[model samples]
Target: MSDKRQQLIETALELFYQEGVQSIGINEVLKVSGVAKKTLYHHFTSKEALVLATLETRNQRFSQWLTVQIAPAKNNQELVEHLFQSLKGWFEDRVEVLGEFRGCFFINTAAEFRDSESEISRYCRQHKSDIKQVIRQQMATYADQPDETLLERICLLKEGVITQAYVAQDMSGPEQAIELLKGR
Candidate 1:
């Protein structure tokens, strides 16, 4: 991506995370990014387009980070643990600084944009489905377990961890998820 485009996306994410999508305007992102309005519009036809791109950008960053975190794993089981280990670190960081952990970005965006066809909402759905697909693929490698069951359990655990981390400001929920996953 061009530096200007990336700057816009980064700026928008910061504003969206802080002031929320509904509150922040395109002008704010343009000003914070230090890019011209025409340039921003030239790159992203509309604010909605920019919103979708921002969501996809965040998803890509998270996926790439997760890939790096799991690179040392020797097998599927280790891979699963590595996944939770990352979440554990995330929660620890959140709790160490402040008790207010931002919940899942995709979930938050979906809630803000209830229309399924909205660019932000569509990107959120795609991002979430992509995450589940990764878990399903990893679970499928475990020949002994049913893929659907494992996916459902992992999804539940993920939601629980995020909820607990947001509300209780602790990593215990994700740690428990790792333990349960290990026993499977």
Candidate 2:
């Protein structure tokens, strides 16, 4: 039998990403997942708990997807190319892990959970930090030293690209980011 907890997370994650945490409710998750409310409650104490679980699962899968997508690069240039190429793939709906681009999930979640001290807000910050760590690790193989400034810029560029792509329906983001990287 399929795990009811995982089913809930997958269903809720899709709904929350497509809509937003504030917009989706527990009843919808139950209906979409076909898991009884009691079963959902058995695994999660509350909807907020379920949201956290969904974010955790998404973060894990996203890190793996990103790592694989950029793993083939041989140099900084290629790393940048691979990064943008991967983003282009996702933007084009080719990245299955991040079905249908809806801006960054963490960004969306953070926007809804504005209290910096809240668990959701903290989780969002941690997710971004982990992504930056991934970038640093990937860049380490090619660079002589860890470049914090470059790391920060890359993170910023990535955020901007996702925003532009999602908010403005601008698909030129990856190319623009690539060109911008070349200037750095």
RMSD list, candidates in order: 3.5, 1.5
Compose the digit string of candidate 2's lDDT tens values, residues 1-184.
2498899999999999999999999999998989999899889999889999989999998999998887787677777788988998898899877898888999999999868899999999999999988888888877778677877888899989989999999989999888988846
Off by over 4 Å in 2: none
Worst 10 residues of 1 by lDDT: 92-101
Per-model TM against the reference: 0.83, 0.95
Computed on alpha carbons, the lDDT of every model, listed in order, comes to 0.74, 0.89
- Model 1 clash tally, residue pairs: 0
Model 1 per-residue lDDT tens digits across residues 11-128: 8887886667888999889778889999898889988888888788879776666656666655656766887877777666533222234767777778898687976777888887
Off by over 4 Å in 1: 74-77, 94-101, 139-146
Tell how far residue 75 is off in model 1, in angstroms: 4.8
